[model samples]
Target: MVRLADVAFAVLFVGVVVRAAVTDLLVPASTLAGIALVVAVVGFSLFDPDGGDHAASLVVHVALVGATALALVLVLTDLTLVSRAVDLALFYLVVLALVGYRRAPLSSTISLFPYLGAFAVVVGLFLLHSLDVSPGSGLAAFPVFATLLLGVCLFVVPRYVEADFLLRFVGALSAVIVLVGLPSLFVGSYSLPFFSVSPWSNATLSPWFVGELPVLRSIFPNPNTLGLLVFPAVLGGVVDLHRTYGRSGSVSLFMVVPGVFLAINAVGLYLTNSRASYLAAAVGLALYAAVVVIDRRAVPVLFAGLAVAAPLVGFGVFRGVVPIDPSNRFALWGASVEALLAGPTLLGAGVVNTSELIAPFLSEGLSGQSSHSSYLSIALRIGLVGGVAYCLLVIGPLIHGAWRFKRVDVGMFALAAGFAVHQLFEGYTLFQYGPGSILAALVVGYVIASVVPEAT
Candidate 1:
């Protein structure tokens, strides 16, 4: 039954990817076949209660992958109607899966209060503010809401969805992105029939790099997105290498696959030239090393060195020794802070048109569509209360795991930590429906399941 579920997931996942590409190519037969596969998968899961339990994880898991793929396709091609149709289908499929699993233990539910509460607060504020917005804006906000719903669904996956399946899911997802994205740097085109490139670039972001270098977006909408999307795969590959080496007590042929995978993804990450992602990757890998690679007793020394080095690094950057670019983010962040201070302190403006929400507060000539920071974006959209909830949602697992150190899966926890810091500069956290958001949901859920005794 699990094998059947796995086969269905692969088919549906491929169908989603192909359906997005061909939907713009006007291939209705292929598109309809994809829809049919979705129906068959859902029907198979629903009709066979026993099979449904086995397939439950696939429903949410595939939905997130499908959602991100469709979103990117929608941006690069003319598939508005197909994207909406698939989105609705996947949303309902998840809801139905949750409905079937009505036996969730109270302990599991309570363990996830941070995630659930954050979702509720964000949605509540959004609804209140969206009520006053125009219909188009309200419609635009639906995807953000949908993204959060799918992310939280990660926590409730049935017991039948084993850890092995989860590991395979992360590995496969990373492999696909890295394998495809790396080749795209040389072979893929950003032109019509393949993709319609957005005119966005790092050059436009700051005066410091006006024409210094070209941004490598690869198959993604932007470099930053691509960088963030590849981050988890790198972490996962690292964990695989460590475990393989530990089992053999030496680097062997078994370690080569993960080593190569990590190296490729790391290269891809560097090519993206996304500084935020660089910081996130560094922070996550550092934590993984501290917890898993280094002795626990020596951890304080390592952190103390970092504490001393951080101020020196900052001072160097401040003194023009590092030549790093701020990318005008300070202005954007200031505008958001100003708007938050102006009014609507408790329940913020809304998730829709967040850039537009802060535009009024921007200094005379500065411009941006987002706060560029997920933490700021959430606070700007749902207010301080929601921001705190989100923080807890991202940080609670790490804290709990650290407190009960023996039970923690440090690899998963470090991935979550990377995501937590990644959001400090990027907006694809709980409120955004992108690849990063989905990965964040999966990693955090896996960490919670790892640490909490009752959750497993």
Candidate 2:
């Protein structure tokens, strides 16, 4: 099993790195590259040793490279969902491994509550539409329904897993995103394939055209996604670097090495001009430095308190807890709540057209801003209860874990802080974009794993 596992992992790593460095090499031959990646992820999960030999066992690691590589290639081709398919395949592999071998993933019944809450909201809302729930015009269509369940499932994965696998996944993903994004620094703005030097092809979005100079989106279509993808990894890598090459008194040389790479990532995120991500990265880095300055132990309490309060407090930096009068987002939030109340009693109008749900909310004076808040979007779509469930089911465990790790690891908590802080403005959840969902789940999962008690 060990030898087979080694061979499988070796094949997977070589194949994925190739796929990343160069994409769709098998294009004319079909998406054989994609196929190979999915197969490798499955194989890694099945053959890797039990109890993981690490401090904890996690299933997310099996498909880490596979999933990340697939995502890169798909973007190069201007695609979505194809890479996520690798995660789906890897998940199925985990299911089969558990069924055949009874290898349990770190089970969390508490995580199931969010699922139930979301399910109840979906069901109750749909049923109420038949009874003509007020303030609502029609039920959520097919897209919203798919979103409701799909979002829940995506969030559920890490909650049930061990932390080691998920964190390794985060670190690896952060590195890949940084690598892909580096091209923008040199080439300015071009697709992964970048076949035409001519800018008017309409085939790809060149960031340079948006401005007089290249801002860097790397392989992604938009600067916002690039910022979101690279920033968290930058934060996480800093934390890991300290632990790996860390020493007391003076800053470690090892810290300088990763710092150089982190600087590259920071530059990429900066050139994106993704204001929200830039702000988040700044905050995360500040927290990282602050932890270094102060005590690591205070991170949990401070972060937890902030996380708890951020949602309620009204401030421009905090993603607008309550929309001010006449603001675009405020108007959107008002409309979405109206629609939610009118449509379904508990469940949201389904995941479909959640953005549209707030359309009526946008006043002519608001200047075309929709719901800029992911927090509001969830509550508006899933109903107030579903939103609360998510806060508990998803955010609760991870916050708890971050608090626990405050005793030992400050970096992880700070990275988590950056992620949570940024999402307030941008929708990086699984349902929002490819990397967003994966990163969000793993962030929560790893933190939760940190807090879990070992065998008594």
Instruction: Supply every candidate's count of residue pairs whose N, Cα or C atoms clash at under 3 angstroms.
Output: 0, 9
* lDDT for each candidate structure: 0.58, 0.49
User: Candidate 1 versus the native: TM-score?
Assistant: 0.70
What TM-score against the true fold does each predicted structure earn? 0.70, 0.61
Predicted candidate 1 versus true structure: per-residue lDDT over 1-456, tens digit per residue: 355545444443344333333343443323433443343344334433223353565565455445544543442234555554454444434433332332346665465555555555554455455545443442544543444334333443322244444444556555555455544444444454644433234442322623333455555667776676667777777777787687899979976766766777776676677898887788778977886756544334544454466557656755668677766666787788888877576777665556887899886677556788788888877788877777777777767666656666677777877887777677666644345765676677777767655522
Deviation in Å, model 1, residue 427 alpha carbon:
2.1
Model 2, 1-456: lDDT tens digits are: 133333433343333333333443422112333443344344444433334443223355544444445433442333555443443333333332321221235462343344345434433443333232222222312222223223322333323333333343445555556566655555654554532111212223246545344555555555666676677756766666665554554577646656666666655566666667776676677777767777666566666666666556545523643443322444566676676777664666554456567666556665345566666666666667667765664556546655555433455456666666666676444333145544564465445435543232
Candidate 2 Cα outliers beyond 4 Å, as residue runs? 1-214, 247-257, 308-313, 316-327, 365-370, 402-409, 431-433, 454-456
